[model samples]
Target: MARVRANPQFCSSKNEWKMKNNNERTAAVLGLGMMGATLAKLLLAAGYEVTVWNRNKDKSALLAEAGATVADSPGAAVNAGQVIVMCVHDYAAATSILSQTEQSGWKGKVLVQLTSGSPAEAEQQEQWAEALGARYLDGAIQAAPQQMGREDTPLFLSGKNAAWDQALPVLKVFAGSPEWLGIPAGLASSVDLATLSGIYGTMMGFFHGARIMEHAGFPVDKYAALLSGILGTFGEFIQLEGQLVHQNRFEKSESPMSISVDATARILRQAQESGIHDKFPRYVAGAFREAADKGLANEELAAMIKVLRG
Candidate 1:
């Protein structure tokens, strides 16, 4: 077992102590998939007595070899540890596993849910945990499994203030910075979804641009290099857009709505002529044109927020 290194207190507001004992530092990890297994290993390496449970018993074999106790069932795992970390496939799978465990086993245990889910689903799970007398915290791991245990790995967390304070020390063991978003049960999930939206939107733009380059017979490597240069300025543009949106001031901009609408129209035409799927370009063009039609042609491209908000 690894030695437990003491660290400075991260939470200022202390909650009622809920560990099994003052010195007991046992953690139960349910669902030994890539993320779950990584977490279990990190906990063990952090000197926690780790108990891991997986639907497929074989999945816990490696962790068992690493000195982790493999539990026969979710209930057994929950009973064995003061803290429970669940990283199942989704909200449904998490609920299914929880249903199998005896509700009485949940009382006094801290349940840290890292399962991917919507805000509504997260809220529902929080209510369920509360009804069962478990302290609940909804979390979203912002990094990949390989990035686990790194100091810069982000874990967005939201729950009752007391529950967060109780789990902060353990959470800090795996995540370099565990950000407390709010006391709302679903706030973490909401932030996770919003971040993913930006990622997907950027990916879609890259795909569309790559397709255009391919149609023009441009070398993909060269196109990718050019794309990287453009993307380097994206952070600045994003910051400006955010400021404009927050201040509700989108006029006198570098790129006006009329220019953006024209550029989008050209991209749509190029996509159509190249026999490429023009849906993406057309969608952008439609949005820009809609903003223009609303007399936002003189405003900055960020003025489209008005159309989107409507």
Candidate 2:
């Protein structure tokens, strides 16, 4: 069974003895890109003995100045710390870096991958780490570099339960309360892709809306403000729609398919009349048109999922 641990109200415990030993205070950060650099800085700020390394030696300068030990190689960095955090470009880059480290260096080390990749890649890395006798945890950071270490930062993680327990202290330094999705090793990546899909879809609509404001001689900033103001309410609506889809309840609801059909068609017509780009509106309108044709016009808006499922 998959073990899921998620508590919205959960906060990182401040009990220092949880990581009492000097070894627990030590950490290694590989890859000094924007996000990786931020992670190393956060560890240093939290009184951790941070050892950092990067392909470009120049990237380690700032960290070295901030009291971080700059390792000459990945293996040296891994050997210097009990917990190893890697946040490189991709799985390929990560693998290339790890290849330089000897298997003996990885043995019994807690390796945390904050690199973003597909679920398959995550599973592959986990297998490789386990073969080297390392405890591996795959994580996906949902926020930008500037947003790291905040109480609300959402970091999705998945791995063995033992690894989760061992790395909890180190993980808490990066995220106030990192969410442990399960032990599949790919749950973090899967959730990351799912959330990104929703985010990008919303961004498309926002971009199209911005065009509408520009064409109508209204300030785009005002439209952006409108979006920001309604995020909470809109999120709630999205949650309800998600529930409807999950339950397969397509009966008449607060928002029916007929309403979306009319709204989308009107938006598309307005875009055409204004001589603006109608691609986004046209696509959405087409989907609703198909749903209507399929006799789901009176069903809930989430019934549109059926159209997609086909």
lDDT of every model, 2 decimals: 0.85, 0.88
Model 1 — TM-score against the truth? 0.90
Off by over 4 Å in 2: 1-20
- In candidate 1, the residue pairs with backbone N, CA or C atoms under 3 Å apart (3 or more residues apart, or in different chains) clash, namely none
Q: What local lDDT score does residue 67 receive in model 2, on the 0 to 100 scale?
A: 67
Cα displacement (angstroms), candidate 2, residue 208, comes to 0.8
| lDDT, residue 295, candidate 1 | 95
* RMSD, candidate 1, Å: 5.9
Model 1, 222-242: lDDT tens per residue? 988888898869889888988
lDDT of 2 by residue, 1-310 (tens): 1112222222122124225655777889999999999999998778777788999988888777666778888999998888999999999999999999889988888899999999999999999999999999999999999999999999999999988988888888888999998879998999999999999989999999999999888999999998899999989999999999999998987898999999999999999999999999999999999999999999999999999999
Runs in model 1 lying further than 4 Å from the true structure: 1-23
